[model samples]
Target: MAETTVAEVMAELATLEDPRTREVNEKHGDDHGVNLGKLRAVAKRLKTQQDLARKLWDTDQTAARLLAILICRPKAFDRDELDAMLRAARTPKVHDWLVNYVVKKTLHAEELRQVWSADPDPVVASASWALTTERVAKKPAGLDLAGLLDVIEAEMKAAPDRLQWAMNHCLAQIGIEHAEHRARAIGIGERLEVLKDYPTPPNCTSPFAPTWITEMVRRQQVE
Candidate 1:
């Protein structure tokens, strides 16, 4: 079989765009119109193609970069490359997919986590906190949970929306996953009131840290 070229992939993506999808995504700061499920189907057909992925990403189209992240060899990107990609990925969905899919799987995750957590760019810092949240849940031996709470208490309420949401997730994770720190996490959430009134669909877990922490803890207890 012939290798799929970037031109071919881009042409296919152009066919997937929907104006309605773009409208909804635009409300959330994403510009792409391609339905993600359909995009993933395209990636599945193409399989991993690091060379093609680079070409797709270089095109700087949201849907193309998204396709790039899905099809690229995550571990193949070096620290600098991932950092550059994160900075370039300004849209919500592209930034998110790159971090969650590619960066998280890279060998430099922890290294980048340390650097990006303190980044002045809130969007970049949000990625750091997201990585931290994963560590808080899975591998938290050396993590300063108390220090994290302190930072969240002081900075989260005043931080930009994306950074605040990331910090809120970390706070909720600590509260949900660790019994000793649960009260402090809840206390911080209650006092700060971040996402306290954010709309939530029925039966969905609220992103408000206190409620999120409590509900998750209850589920754990039931289990």
Candidate 2:
């Protein structure tokens, strides 16, 4: 198969854009509406997809950028390159896609987590906490669980919105996945009271750590 140029890949993405999805996503502040399945189809077709992925990410359109996250070579990125991508991501959804899809898969995740978690930039900090949250969810060995709890306890309330969300997520993961840390995670959640009152959609557990942990534990008991 012939290598597809970035321009050709972008045109393909434009062809896949869904007007209704775009409208719905735009209401939530994201600009593009390409279907995920369609994007994956496009990913499956391109040769040297990472080259196209880099250019697409630079476009910063949400749908194209999401495709970029899906296709980009994690190994191609140094910490600086990853940091730049995190810094360039303007919206929460984009930041999240990059963290979950790109950063989480990278070898530099721990290194990035340590550096970005302490950065003053909220986006960078959010990405760090996000990576850490995923790490906890997967029950990785030798994590500084105590140190993480300390940070959450100390700064969750005062952290920026996106960063606070990711920190709460980390706390929840620890509670849900790490039996030894569950009690302290709940304690931290109770003390911090992060997202305690956020309205939950019907049939969805609250994302607040204490409630989330309690509800999951209850479900496990019944099951």
Candidate 3:
């Protein structure tokens, strides 16, 4: 059997584009129209093909890059390569998958997290906050939860949309996971009022920090 080529995968993704999907994705700053479920199925069939993943990523098409993240070995990338990839991933979904799927699994995550947290680029800083939120939930020791609250209080309100949202998630996670910082986190959310009026669908928990923190805490108590 022949190995799949980048051209072949690109053609396949071209065939999977949906107009409505593209419309919806574009509203959120993603350019791809390929359904994620279908894209994952393609990755499953392709399996772990690092060379092929590199080829696909170099194509710079959003769907191909998404597929690349799925197929590549996360640990194969060095710090510089991962940093380059994150900067190149300008769109929302690709940036997200790279952070969540690839960067998070790498040995370099913590180092990159510290570097990106102070980045001048809000998109990059957002990725750092995403990583920090993970630690807040799963590994809270040694992290300055109060310091995080202080930063969120000072900067989150005026932040760009992506950075603001990421900071808000960190705030909510700190409130949800840490008993010591819960009150301060909620209080910061109340004052900042970021995402306070964002519409949430029926039965969905609000992303607004105070509401999100309270609801998650309530669920924890019930559990």
Local distance difference test scores for all models? 0.94, 0.83, 0.95
Best candidate according to lDDT: 3
* Residue-level error in angstroms, candidate 3, position 185: 0.7
In model 2, which residue pairs have backbone atoms overlapping below 3 Å? none
TM-score of candidate 2 on Cα atoms, chains taken together: 0.85
Clashing pairs in 3: none
**What residue pairs clash in candidate 1, if any at all?**
none
Tell me which of candidates 1 and 2 scores higher on TM-score. Answer: 1
For model 1, the run of ten residues with the poorest summed lDDT: 2-11
Q: Report the lDDT tens digits of candidate 3 across residue range 1-223.
A: 8999999999999999999999999999999999999999999999999999999999999999999999999999999999999999979999999999999998999999999998999999999999999899887788888888889999999999999999999999999998888999999999989999999999999999999999999999999
- The C-alpha TM-scores of every prediction are 0.98, 0.85, 0.98
lDDT of 1: 0.94
RMSD (Å) of each candidate, 1 decimal: 0.8, 2.5, 0.8
How big is the positional error of residue 46 in model 3, measured in Å on the Cα after superposition?
1.1
Give one digit per residue, the lDDT tens place, for model 1 in 83-116.
9999999798899899889988888999999999
Error of 3 at 135 (Å): 0.9
The deviation in Å at residue 156 for candidate 3 is 0.2
